[model samples]
Target: MNTEQPLKERLKQILNQNGHALSFEEREILLHELIDLHGQAKEGKNNETEQIRQAFLHNLCHVPQSLTHETFSRFFAENIKPADFRALEWEMPEQYFQITEALYLLRSHIETEKVFDYVTELLVHALRSFERNGEYKKMIELLQLVPVPPSAMNQELLSLRAQAHIHETRRVQHFRQLLYKYLFLQALLIFVAFPILFVKAENGAIAKTIEEATDVEMTEERVQYLSYADGLYWSIITAASIGYGDITPVTNIGRIIAAILGSMGVITIGIIAGLILDRITPRNF
Candidate 1:
């Protein structure tokens, strides 16, 4: 609170006055921590807990803005108000916040961390939702709204935070697009692949292969998106061509679809393997 000393001067003093070896990542991490704490302060209520949270928030907020690039929770930190925390229900976990008490050390944490935890939970939920259904449009909007640290602060550092942020942002964008494709492909399995796989049944019932393979449910409203596990399962089932005896397409059209998935599934796995080989091989990632 020294008026004569500007915020930057104070921070420079804190950072440089005690000459410590700090890497660019470390520097950016510290800045992110500071911003997160400050965001904590801005949302404090009038209660005693709020007072403490605000105090910490203020201390961190007063630090000189980073001259180097670092991304932190710019969205919430910049726009946060004291009363925003009160509307926690909107971000609350499925109307059953109490269930998560066991997961997060709610009782021991500073009130600010509790809020941070809340934000983290919401984030995971949103990401998982997007991952499941390839709900591309909504997912992208939420991605933009994520509370990443700003990349503009801290000009003097081993590595510019901006570059790191860009890398991360690009990575996320790529996955989002890729996941979207996979989701579409999952649904497309029925519409595109099945029509080609159906074989005529002697009982006048079109048997996929003289086998009692389950019919895959091809509902327009119901979209089945695979997860990391599901994708793995898909690979296993598709690679081995051993239907799980569950979740199959039954109609002649469905059979055709399965046939397509079965064949594509083999090459798909190979393509993934090639990519993995390429990455460790060099630039695969």
Candidate 2:
């Protein structure tokens, strides 16, 4: 009887079978058996070891089964090479893609942060691959699959996210609408600040610092308290981050308010500038 041939054939058949119906324990058992077989084969023949590895990966890719965290931890420990980490920086190998896809499918079943970090790193590389191919929508879709930790996000991921948003906005023809929203927010901040400043000025919180420059003597009736128009103008200038120094805040509360407004204005301007650059930049790059 050709027992070895039959065993090899049966293993191949199991590899071809979909393991989605199998429980985690069942999958773990099968995985352990395969690893043992591969390890035994590795002792005498390199070709058999390679063949078994390829079959194992092929089976892993096709099966949507979830394995236990310990199984995955062991699997990665045995399989992951230094080359696998290097591949993330350059062209991603097809094997890596398959592995990442398989892990992504079982993301919800993952319990350990270590296993999840592996999945996240792989997916980030996959996202970069999509970005290189100008597949922004696909990149965005893949990103939405996992809840990537904020700590793992580098500048590369942030750039990918921005590109995805720009591509989506361009596709949906909502660029103008987005611009309008930003402008509305800016205007809203200005108007909201206006009311607060007007109230402060009404309480004698604001004063004109250049009273002598205007050759006006300070008096009870002739005191140049900031007017409503001046307060609104100050709010506009403060939000624009263009402090002209024509008016000044006398109270500590008023200075604090101005400082906050100035910081917000700078951030808003930066956002607007980034939006404009994104709109004007060519997509071909």
Displacement of the residue 227 alpha carbon in candidate 2, Å: 2.0
Q: What is the C-alpha lDDT of each candidate?
A: 0.41, 0.59
lDDT, candidate 2, 1-285, per-residue tens: 755675577567666553346655565566666676675553566555555555454444333243324565455456643224422322333444556555654445554575566665666666776777776766656655544577877786778777777786675456657778878876876777554665464454343433456766433322235666777788888778658887766555566777877888888889778877665443331
Off by over 4 Å in 1: 1-154, 190-260, 269-285
Q: lDDT tens digits, residues 1-285, model 1?
A: 553234334344444422355555555555555454434433333443343333322322323233212233333334334443332222222322332332233333335555555445444444444434544344444444443343422232112223333445665567656655865785565343332232221112344223346655323322233233443444346535746855554344444445666777676667557654432231111
Choose the strongest candidate by lDDT: 2
- Model 1 shows how many backbone clashes? 29
Error of 2 at 12 (Å): 8.9
Residue 180 of model 1 has an lDDT of 59
